[model samples]
Target: MRRPPMISLFTGAMGLDLGFERVGFELRLTLDINKFVCETIRANRPDIPIICNDIRRVSTDDILRKAGLGVGGPVVITGGPPCQAYSTAGKRRSVNDTRPSRGGDLVFEFLRVIREAKPQFFVFENVTGLLSAAIRHISFYERMRKKEHEIPPDARLGTAFEKILEEFISTGYRVKWSVLNAADYGVPQARKRLFIVGSRDGVDIPFPPPPTHGRPDSLDVIMGRKKPWLTLKDAIWDLRNRRDLEYLPFPSWGKYLKYVPPGGSWVDIPRELQREAMGGAFYSQGGRRGFYRRLSWDKPSPTLVTSPTMKATCLCHPDQDRPLSVEEYARIQCFPDDWKFVGTTQEKYKMIGEAVPPPLAFAVAKCIMKAVKEDPGNPYSDPHLKFNF
Candidate 1:
């Protein structure tokens, strides 16, 4: 029998690993720095090995020795590293930015694992902000903290992405990348994420799979609306009828929502409420987009986060006054209702919010599968290739 391809999941938070699990990939090993997330992986699958700490702190030789992948272990590694430093919503600081460890260096840590394990394939996921990240050589450049965030006089685009590609190629793999929307798969959210997959040159590396659910049934693929995108109503209405459906009022923002209608937000509040609602931001630019932003029943959901209740990026229900519960957020991310997190509500939200929706993961996985199927031939253990820098 041809064995199922085993997957070693890194930074396997929120059981986004579970999505890959659902699609028949046997998860052989899981790694995470958070003990809770690691424990969740263990609790759910007591049989699988879970390494519960930073990869930098873990011994590569020890991990390989334990996984028994010394030789002939055909494996694929998948993970979504914390990407705040590179996030569009965050300060677009460089890899050396003192903000935190969630920058390109963490990704390089993942590459370190790839170099040591020599996995046949690996998948990396992150927010689309990577499309514009930059790179610099320290000797030729000024310090990062020279006062303000000033792009180098001649900085080119995709420098960060290309640097990431170079890291994977250094580990002996051919790499390709693309951004994907969750709604293209069966997930109801319009979450967009960048996916990069690297395979040993000439072995097989598939392009992303075409949309399975939202295929066009209409005019120009770009402009026309085929089946309209999935909406919050498509997700929670059934739960609404159930007595178990959960809802909690945010003492701060939930009350103000009482006056806003379905598909309406702070702008919809009466002139009095708008003034009261906006307060300081009344004169703020940028559309105050999420303020009292009621989700529309006719469109896909905005990207979910660890804290939907937070106003900076609210994810409130289109009709209900309360913010979407952990359950609804999980659903929006395509997690099974019973897929429990082993942490506080905030932690659970963080796990769920940070994950690349599984449907999206599976869609990308299938693309890699297609690439493998097309060319199963082996490549030289020692290969010759140069990057087009």
Candidate 2:
């Protein structure tokens, strides 16, 4: 059977596109705002049409024209917008910041294009924080001074998710979303992301299958139902022996990383050393587990950030006393060893960190392919099929 064609937006580094391609999806056109990312995509896949401009400047008409598709086509749209607005690790700005339009905000841009292109299926990927991000109105700030802190019923948690789902449902799509762990789906990292899958034909694609791997002592692994999660050693141990691979210098915090054994973090520092290593953060209340953290050869890596060497979310090597290298970052994200990324060290890290892990995307692509192949007319067989997010 012929695979579906896809029009990709926010196609950073083409990590998501690569996974879909692996499952036989044909990518028609790719769009992204970052010049460097676009360059990387072009360098790798020269034949694919690319639109390297702000998504706001491009119209649905432009996307269709470039993709050589009409209003109705077997196209699957996929992308993760700038996630800081919905990331719990960040300030959780929600809709407070301005974008192209209230309608053109990147999340809504995904919807707008879907409405205009009217594709048969669309997949939305984002940080899990979208599940609870409140959609605070501008007036909520002014009212904050007069009232005690509390979420208004209408503006409570999960409002952002509800609003997104409602828009898709109203536009004649059946949708379901799930939080997936990359480690479970064969990636050698513990990153978790939110995936929303929709079909204009109301064919409910079940959430990707149960995890295939986990911790050795985890119930499934011990019970013989699944394999243990991939370890950091599994992903990058070969690089440790290679003399040709370039590595980043040990961070200024290297001295502290040397003291953090595998599977350990800031808490392992002596009380006096903690003050010297973490400064004011040593006294902070919460367990800042990411601080001075070193990867364990026996476990999957932590979710990567754009910068691995930062003091807050230090991804120190297990025994090397340095940050993971750019090549290691690409490997963890499942990019081929030879896939070239074009940019400065930090820029390269940004591209790698922002990507959807290829194997995780592959699992999702496989699920969608199965549903499409079965041609389940009403895939949402359950009445309670909508995600409760």
Return the TM-score for each candidate structure.
Answer: 0.84, 0.89
Clashing pairs in 2: 204-379, 214-229
Q: Given candidate 1, what's the lDDT at residue 270?
A: 79
Candidates in order have lDDT scores of 0.67, 0.80
Residue-level error in angstroms, candidate 2, position 231: 0.7
Worst window of 10 by summed lDDT in candidate 2: 380-389
- Could you give candidate 1's per-residue lDDT for residues 55-170 as a string of tens digits? 76887676666665653364577877777767766456645443335655778777777777777777888888777776642321354444335656324446777777677677
Candidate 2 runs further than 4 Å off:
99-104, 137-149, 152-155, 247-251, 376-389
Candidate 1 collision pairs: 265-292, 266-292
* C-alpha positional error of residue 145 in candidate 2 after TM-score superposition, expressed in Å: 11
Candidate 1 wrong stretches, greater than 4 Å: 2-9, 98-104, 135-150, 153-158, 215-228, 242-248, 378-389
**Candidate 2 vs. true structure, TM-score:** 0.89
Rate residue 349 of model 1 by lDDT. Answer: 77
